[model samples]
Target: MPRKRYAEDLSVEELRLLLIEKQRARRQKRLEHFRRSGRLVVVDDHPTQPPLETLASRPLSEETPPATANPKHTRLDRLLLAIEILAVLGLAFVLLNGFTLIRDLNREVVAMINQPTLTPTPAITAIVLPGGHTPPNSPGGPRPNDAEIPEHLRPVMLSLPELPTPTPSVEQAIRIQIPAIKVDAPVVQGDGWEQLKKGVGQRLGTPNPGQRGNIVLSAHNDIFGEIFRDLDKLKPGDQVILYSNQRAYVYIVQQTQIVEPTRVEVMAPTQEPIVTLISCYPYMVDNQRIVVTARLQE
Candidate 1:
């Protein structure tokens, strides 16, 4: 065989012609071999690649693959989308249930804790003498001798008109203002979540402001506008004003304390007119309570 020529020995035009000739010969040989073996079903005499126009015009359904996506792939995409939606809904459902359960548990714990620790203070009916002293035993003092009172005044007292019983109003708290902490918020009736969410809440059955017993009020420290968020900042002698039925009742802070949530003695009744404010301890945690007690400033 003659000596083979290396690609580096050929000029640019010569190298191009040589490659074209080699490719043409290879194609011719392949066609003849396939023909002689009776394996060729179609033949093309083109010496170069088919034109773009010819390829584009060919029937895609028969000669080329379909352009539309596979049916199985489409179904898989739809399934994946549905699963993602389901996952999001499930997560939301779980979160809602968790919040409800937590609220219910908290309410239960509060009910159990506040199971009437001390007896309510009894109403006082006393007759004070001019010297400001009470005589004999408590609750049933002896009747003074008739010489002490004029005979004419005693008959007048016996014939005194019976005063009508005042009707109790169903109004809830209207407003609250704490001067020291600069808190002014509307007050709601119940200590439930809905009421607290609006503002401060007054526990049902607790004495109203200016009343003789304890006036129990509570709010969240970290939520519901954080009306009592700065409760711990208050010192004794601060003033809190609660408005009800268009009347304002002022209270002077007496003490502040932190106790476990189970300690319900803070809500007990007292003979003196007082107000109690309760909030969760440490800002965001409900592990303890911050109790702030104030007495009505007559």
Candidate 2:
């Protein structure tokens, strides 16, 4: 009631010492309270947990987790799953299409073999030529039924036979004179019948004088600009005479074609007899072949 004078009312150095003592007393009181309420926690220099004083500062609701579940991880997960599914589908589709194409090609080859073509086709005349005697209606033949012939049957060579037996030559076979076609080049019987022979084909066989299969005879039309000089002038009705052995063999022109050199199938032998003469096409290009199909007449 009167003026109080204790450490609390003293100077700063004395007040700090007094505050420490007061804090110790208050901590003892709290320990007593906790022990009585069965909430006492053991104290050690390095305690397993922080003092209850620190925990008391935070709200109980905040310290603990919420009642709801956690949010999920997504977005990139969905994109990756979709990409995997699409890749599987694309691979399946490609395999299915590839198998289908192979089956179709095999079917086409089988169908080709099954279809028989013995008689000459008027439209496709090289495989089997127009047969029998040329009527009077036919060009270069005697008067017969010239006007009555169908337009499609205008001109065709008779089918070729297997390679004919080499007849005795009236002169050397080396000197083949095709008077109708007027090709007076000497016949050189070898792989090189002509200068362009070496690099033009796949099959390089031993060329016998009288042999079966297609006989490919090639020459440059512009050799010194005079070889096959008369080849382009040949008409369908014109003739190509091969003088071989003692007998002279005659060939009538059937079909003429200008095609890329890659089409080597033209050199394949036909069921019928055929002679194919080939040379570079056009005025200056060597990429295409000018093919002429002919058959022996006599």
Candidate 3:
């Protein structure tokens, strides 16, 4: 081999950059070898390599090779990514019943980790009033159980004019928005139910406004392997808006909860109208179900 050029061969700044380039080239060759050997890798070739300091230090949370990412020649990154993908996919396959199980679970679990956790606050709890505080003539009188509407006991309530005929309008698909990532995915209802696994689905039931229940919708985080790649970037406060019949129903994200595939109670009816968005964790397959619930903004 020819003698290697020393740092003295160039200016100080040039030397630092040249060193990075050398390291990068060495990285590329190794990556090429892996590719030839049929190993999955992160592929990124660049003129300017990251600083040695950067390669040496990092925040622990960002250790993975990235979603659907090609090899960047880092042993740690590649190893971590392989581990994660394997773990997520294996669990999903064991629990869910399909090939896309891993992808689904990855999307859900990863999204959960990426989402903002909302803890109920004592201050908010204090705002709620105890029953029986209202005056006798007040509109909201004391009531033991809310299920008994006072109007049911009055003759005048029966005389109320027949409810206006419901306008016959075609049902429409809902829209989802992710401000932080600039993502706009049309959420088809029920697709989150049984029809889609490692696939997208549209809701089957007509969306009932003010129903005080879960209106579930779902989609594939990724398939044919293109990554949202940023599906993992959905943070708390993300807006999942639904537009139908020329009206936009807004849902403010509350919290992201991860439940085992068998935990069906989380999808149970709520006391207030809310929208539930479900998808596989990480992206692309239904390994685990991620349930994102948002109450309609009053």
TM-score of each: 0.44, 0.37, 0.36
> Which residue pairs clash within candidate 1?
none
lDDT of each: 0.71, 0.53, 0.53
What's the CA error at residue 77 for candidate 3, in Å?
Answer: 99
List candidate 1 segments past 4 Å from native: 1-172
- Evaluated against the true structure, the overall lDDT of model 2 is 0.53
Ordering by TM-score: 1, 2, 3
Q: How many backbone clashes does candidate 3 have?
A: 32
Top candidate on TM-score is 1
**Residue-wise lDDT of candidate 2 within 265-298, one digit each (tens)?**
6766665545676665554433355778777564
Error of 2 at 26 (Å): 99
Tell how far residue 114 is off in model 3, in angstroms: 46
Model 2 misplacement above 4 A = 1-173, 191-212
Error of 2 at 210 (Å): 6.9
Candidate 3 local Cα displacement, residue 65, angstroms: 99
